[model samples]
Target chain A: MEFKKYSKTLFFGATLAVLAGCGGNDAVTQDDVNASTDGQVQPVITSDGSNGDSAVNGEQLGQEAQNLQDQASSAIAALPEVETVYFDFDTSVIRDDSREVLDLHVAYLNANPAQNVVLEGHADERGTREYNNALGERRGNAVKNYFMVQGVSADRIEVISYGEEKPAVIGHNNAAWSKNRRVEIKY
Target chain B: MPFKKWIKAAAFTLLCVTQQAVADLTIEITQGNDRATPVAVVPFAWLGQSPLPEDVAQIVSDDLERSGLIRPLSRSDMLSLPSQKSEIYFRDWSLLKQDYLLIGQVRPSVSPGVLTIQFELYDVVRQTRVLGEVISGKVSELRSRAHYISDKVFEHLTGIEGAFSTRLAYVTMRKDEAGQNKYELKVADADGRREKSILTTYKPILSPSWSPDAQHLAYVSFETGRPGIFIQNVYSGKRRQLTAFKGLNGAPSWSPDGEKLAVVLSKDGNPELYVIDLNTYKMKRLTKHYAIDTEPEWSPDGERIMFTSSRSGGPQIYQLDLVSGETERLTFEGNYNARARFSPDGTEIYFVHQKDGIFHIAAQELANNRLRILTQTPLDESPSVSPNGSMLIYATQEGSRGYLGAVSVNGQIRYRLPSQRADVREPAWSPFLTN
Candidate 1:
């Protein structure tokens, strides 16, 4: 087997502090492409916005996800080494790279049922603190929902949002904000 | 005794005691009211300690100018120093275009540690004494009394009641000795005097909302692992965590009656609005939408709650009727609007509105739905209206540091309350603080 070094495009230091984590082997796939295509993303709001967006059925999606994971059980083995996932500005929607890291975390969490993990979410300091708190929590909940879909119990995952209060990198520019808006998984 | 105890605890955190008394915030009046009443507040004759511990007249002048409605004559421009009505130089002040004059004498009272303060306001144009008052209080209470004198003088000249007697609660964050960010909850006089630290922690603190009576403060503190809503007495500094649910407990807004607090909690899956009864600890979930409904603020009538909700795909304020269980959209002009609060009279709603990728404090008249952006600066958030509903203080940033800025309700007067070292945000002006 070719042991290719996992690649990443994060401008943040390779020196992220992760709890119960290995060396940065967390494969970041499609992040550079996602960042370049961000200009094409439409504004989330429009007139009569609520009519088109329906509430996500988390439980039903969890069951369907569990069936998919049950069939691909052999492919998942070792826990993912990466512990941090970056998000788009003002959005908690999981990107492709973030989903890849979380999928590996789901494999790690499934292999060890005794293991419990905490998801701490954060946001850039562009918006109001309280709304950012909600945004951060939404990011955490998005990760937690993914874990539950992969057969992890709700109690095993703890979600906390710091809003814009705590920043991994302290600066006002987009470079710092992109790194700041993230979810860090701690085991 | 509680205040004294708090002072003792706060004294060590102070960097320079002398500088803070004179210069804390650099006030820049961006928009001047052409009709602003110009008044000269002559220096008050001090009869207290050898070197007066405080400058009472300067404090009063700062308070008046901070309000944006009054223009204080520069101390140098004063043709002559007058301390009483008998030393009348009305002709000179009139030449300087002063409409009114204020002078006072602060003398030691018969009781030890007490000073009897007297001040007189004269209408220069009318050439008659406008108002006169005498107050006696402990030396430590001199600053608050100076504000009191300004309040009386303000009300006598203008029909509106003065909010100078009020106080402010805000958060200041800076790097501590060990290079870790230290967050402090500080309470100060409206004129930025007697600033004392109520609570100092390494964790982040935000949303300092004062109780209706101004006796307590409810805020979001991250002291214990994660974010939690905490309430602490302003005088005692004793605090208790109101909620520490599993997911999120932030943005605590006290009700009008001071009986319940409207907060954002995410324990029941998504971030929803919840009101917690302060007496019984019972939680009443207000909204159950999958979309984020947070930053709950109660109207003065206590009948409706205005909150920030992304239920419309983006953050826009929505009003919830407490009795009828119905919600109505309040803000339709902006795709991003949050951190909404009410004016004192409940006639207007002030919130941070985003336009052209810049956030400005905007007010919506409840009667006609007229939208008016009240601030000139960018990235302004957390608009806390003054008790009298004249000006609102919000957070703005320059480079990476945050500073507090205030703008009048009419979008005319403006000033920035920037600190020398610390980055300050979340300034909650106290209600009419009656002692």
Candidate 2:
């Protein structure tokens, strides 16, 4: 299911605890990605049309527009093939392989300011329905928090947990459960 | 209670006999007492012009047999069917090795449509009468009269209040003609008969909780394309939405006094337990933790609330005192423990505990912190206790279908109540009815 952008006060305490325990402090940010890839990185730009000192010649304006289009196209091209992240049973901790996919999503969100994404979280049907709903919400928030740390705007990301109500696959085996416990990035 | 008015004003006429094609829930006693006291329930004498509408003695016998505490003898095994103390011969029952004997008579009263029942219980070996009583009811209430007699006899023999008249509320999921799953909330007699669909929806419905007065049921429904908590009058079918927050609104449990509901809401932030006043519709947040905290259940005395929280890294049961505002963890043995409920008397707590990768229903004594697993089947969840605290009903898997099962508090006896076509789950036992 898709959800519209909703501004919520994301709880960073859990994110901080998760980061502290996982000890990877090397999460890539928008600035790092820009510095490493773009040769002519422009100055910080806000959501509005122009940055400070808006007066500029038409040639310079056209040149800046070209640069922005090139950066956005390259960012979209850099996205990973996977769009969904899988978690361990009963735990919302993101795995190493899933982090790469989330990084791609973060970069894409940064390049396209008008675009918003929804994180759909799900769980296996092994626990009580209400408890699984809470677990699914935690998993969705885990992904949302990761995007926040990677320089994605919190308002651009909405989350909703379907819990065990909706399964990606219809089976009771471990193979089905592994696929069901996932967060899909829908843009 | 106001529920009587609802039943009287119900719009949908109950098709009790017309829908008998789908078999009613039948109980299969999986285990029982090894040395159950052998008893004989003699067929009652009918003094009316026509045969009695019901066999009161037979109904009582079935009640006792379902309890698993006593084994009633077959009617064919009895040498004589006695209806009075003077007609019962002590040597006859003693020869059958019966420990207890029950005899009764039903006669039409002078008042039109009224019937009077007289019954007595005797100790066969001791040759002493244990109980004698007379009950009056209309002809249509014969089944209820039988259950009342069973309750009285049970209390006299076992010292535990009988739960024969209580009811069970559960959810059933089935596929509609369009091949889409349809969920329904149903209530049935404790013996697993006379089921009525209280609510039906195309979307999923979870967690059916009975009000303390047994008049209303509060559950989470996804009818509006989003989850919301709704309270509906079981008889009248009148329903009102309670919560429809943006993120999560689920797990509604009524307080002891029925003035408030403990619910889980995520509107403020992460999933947290909140107590909402029924009169004002105002909410008071109970937990401020970042980790998931939900599934709050009230204690019988209204002084404490037990809930499930993952604040300690993984989900576990926790108790919060409303008066003192002090919170303490209650589970440590398992890595996962959720959906905890307090026994009616408040002496013990039942919950779903995961052990060795399989989920089972478990009980923990509040006095010494001792825990005992009660179910042998894996994937058991939603354990609800009877009003008298004698039996617990929960949901478990039988092959691929979900079914409801009951187990005694001592874990000595067990029974299964499987649905005919749908998957039955999320059973909530109603409190003892005073009416």
Candidate 3:
């Protein structure tokens, strides 16, 4: 647990310095993505993994860090790209693909503690209105719980359930229902 | 608690109100009893006016025909216009297979702006007069007086008090010229006439519940960008926000005595049920469960509350004994059941039930636990019982637009109320208005 905490902070600090290096421009440029992979994040993971070891032995450590960096970067990059997580009818269990997306959100929140996020939960127009309200709350809470487990601050996270009142798509078909049953991550 | 509270209550005065009185609902009986007793309603003789403001007899005939208990004959089929009992020949009605006949006359009363309405209901087969009455009201109240006569005649015929005089509240939504959705909370007569908008907002309005006295309506409004419960006086246009809790201030239902409200609030944490006293604004939490528990409705006697809860792995109706605080599950036959309300007689509970992926209105008898599906339409919801306990009105979809539909308690009769331009939903049948 201690090593995990140290590595988390180290990763966050390196991410911030890289972010500052590309300051005054908040948009995610191609250069920013390449820099995150090839320059700042990769070197720190190798140096941090090797500690006081000799430079000759750094190659083995660098190779190991490269694998870890690639996995983490890919997962993190996939987060903001996926704005919504869909759920099965009447169920709130997060899917496996959603776990990776939430992990990216957790890393972003850990890196920027001052930021806040709101998880908007929705459902298809089925059953009763009040029951759907409760169902939407359960879905939003499921996402909120996953965020907390990923080390996101509970206070910075808020949840609102629109229930079945607001539909992402206006239709009565199964396609609309599947799209409507979701939790939207809003920052 | 303070004088400032009354000032805060007046904030709703700024809301926009629009009413449309141009058209009334055209009755189309989708189904009825094959053995329904045939009846005839002749055009009333108009006196002391260039023309009658409303077709009083037509309104009465439509009300009776829509009840599913009686069939009214077409005006062209009437051999003679009879505004009095002396002009009626019982043999003519018998030839038309009419078991009953109704005749009326409208005239200017001595009291200015008032009209005198006299109507007679007769049993043609028995060759006897069932009942008669003279109603005095403003000229503008012609439709209501017609409904009043329908109620009296219905009571004399079926032994069940008529709900024709009551009103219904519902929500209508439409997109404005700006392409933004605009919602209006409207109250119309039981016959869907003279619809008056009580509240209008750009946000969604839902779950309208009527006070027992029929003077106020409690509904959930999202005007403040968050869900909040508001109680509005249907007459004076006065309204006050009952609660604007952080999460889920929804599903407000009036206690039978009108002293408190059962609401669903999530201010504490997860969604749960709570009852709020109207006098003191005090709230008492009712359920303590990890699962979702909401949609609380009071029994007619006010001794118990039926609500929807997923504690048993799926949505089902559960009864909570208010005095003893013991909750017992009431529905087990279906995998999904919700939005249950006790029948006015307290012998059954009507709810939204799902089967074969289609949602319909259903009723469960309290004595034998006999569950009967009452509707065949898709996405039927918000079932509300009439004050007389003979009919139910619920929200349903016709094609892609929302509309209100009514079905007799026995599921023998059905009708739909659809506005030409907007989607109507969430009907709350008002209680009997005692003058």
Candidate 4:
């Protein structure tokens, strides 16, 4: 079941790439790749003017764009999803499941130094508002400390906690609460 | 003279027995001298294109009435429905026996999609404007602004600040199609309106406690498959994990001073209370009992603590002197009593008590050793007294769902605030706001 879930995620990612290529405007943002690559990086700038052999240049531009897209897709496929970190009720301690996810996150941070990531901490609805805020912060710091220990630069990671104010699920049951108490990695 | 002495002695003996019976029966008068004040809230008038917002006046009426301190007069019975101060006729309100009048108008502001709400409060007897304020927000905030105005009028007349601007945090649970349960942490206005979910999960979330500053929350989350305490900030969305011990880490209580937190952890085998300093991140054990000692609450003065323990076989309330480290049993009236909270004045303690096969709220006078049952509910638990000690909020099971309810400290009035969609539990009333 877990292997099927991963394969489905990869398939969905490839479909998203193909859809983006068909769309006319293709402007790559900083989030596209790590900026500090030590190889010969060729900038692919497309001509926006309507005059010079428009179809030919458009085809060439599409080919170059496809090459970058393929690179990004492969990179994403190689990366593991960091959703395994689970927190105990009102606790910030890293559990066994968290260790697996943290290992992937640490590897990603080590490979990309120019990339900055934000760790957002959350809590399930149970306690008072202020206490949950503190609890969320503690969870974020726990992840940050783990990455620092794994040779990632502490300055590259930021932590924030949204305590019981933003829930992923609206249901008021155990299933929803479990999903709400999580830490997300945003790059 | 001998015959007269004999008659006096017999009468005195009879009086003593009657007093003893009254003490044993425990009839508590929860109501105070201040009855729910009567006020008239006229529907808001529309000045421009849009129709007046739906039920703005009704929302304000319900908010005040549910607080058990105000009785909003019906609009149908009003002599005149006024939308502004000039349209109000004090003589008509006075004739209708209404003490106060609220009038408001919603007009289009310079900014598009924004509405300006101008409101006024009039003293019917004095024939003067008691309060007037203008607020600007999106049309969606109209109901919230109305509640704020009602709170102001209540405070102006009663000299006690209303909790209209305060928010309530609670947990809701529901079962899925496969029978797995989902839980969510929700925040809403004190009146149980405008609920927004903060967290949702399959794991159980318990014992959410707010910090004194109202900026942070500490709760127990079981998402990682074990109970641990976590703290999160509301504004910036930051979270920090405080502890992940083996046995248990639950029931976090913030110190009144906001520098430390008191929580229940069982790292040393038995559940006990520990205080963690926020700055240093160091924990100090407060209790060393082999029995379960949990639910620590700091006193208003921050001099001592009160908590629930089973040191004497059955669960009972105990007080710990911070200076002398001496513990004393506080409850002696019932075999099952827990979750004790000190009154804001520190003169009495309120806790859940089970007597005669029924669970209810009991208050003990610290000075006179007098105990009184304040609730008549069958299963009352987690009693949290208001800052003024005039009311207490607790959670109990209604059919199959948990519902939050409030009772006057005197035990005269009782009302339940149940959610229409989900089961609600674990309500913590915020302290009195300064302004």
Measured with DockQ on alpha carbons, how good is candidate 4?
0.01
lDDT of 3 by residue, A1-187 (tens): 3234335434432223322311111122122111112112211111111122111122332343354445555444223667688777876766656665665676666666788889888889888877877667667766775665455666677777888878899899999999998889888
C-alpha lDDT score of every prediction, in listed order: 0.76, 0.76, 0.76, 0.63
Candidate achieving higher TM-score, 2 or 4: 2
lDDT of 1 by residue, B92-209 (tens): 9999999999999999988988888889999998899879888988767777787888888777767778998888888999998899999999898775566788999999999999
CAPRI category for model 4: incorrect
- Which model scores highest in TM-score? 1
Over the stretch A15-123, how does candidate 2's per-residue lDDT look in tens digits?
2221221221112112121122122312111001111111112233234335444555567634456788887787776675775576667667777778888888889
lDDT of 2 by residue, B1-435 (tens): 211121121111112332334544766677767566788989889999976656788778877877878878888899998898888899999999999999999999999999999999999989999999998998778877888888898888889899888889999888899988888999887877668898999887888999999999999998987788999998899999888776678899999999999988776446767788888766676776555678999999999989997666567899988888788899998888999999888999999999998889999999988999999888899999999998999999876678999988878777788777898999999998867
Give the better candidate number (2 or 4) by DockQ.
2
Residue-level lDDT tens digits of model 4 in B108-184: 99998888888888888888888998888877776567668767876786686676666666777777778777888
Q: Candidate 4 regions off by >4 Å?
A: A1-187, B1-35, B52-55, B235-237, B432-435
Question: When superposed on Cα atoms, how far off is each prediction in RMSD?
Answer: 12.0, 12.0, 14.5, 22.2
Candidate 3 chain B minimal-lDDT segment of 10 residues: B6-15
lDDT, model 1, position B168: 83
lDDT of each residue in B1-435, candidate 3, tens digit only: 111111111111101112344542434556666666788988888887567667888888888877878878988898999999889999999999998999989999999999999998888999888888888898778878888998998888889999999999999888999998899999988988878899999988999999999999999998987788999999998999988666688899999999999888766455667788888766677776545679999999999989897766678899988778678899998789998988888999999999999999999999999999999998999999999999999999877788888998888778777667888889999999876
- The list of candidate 2 runs beyond 4 A from truth reads A1-71, A75-84, A99-118, A146-157, A184-187, B1-24, B46-54, B107-114, B138-140
Off by over 4 Å in 1: A1-79, B1-26
Steric overlap count per candidate: 0, 0, 0, 85
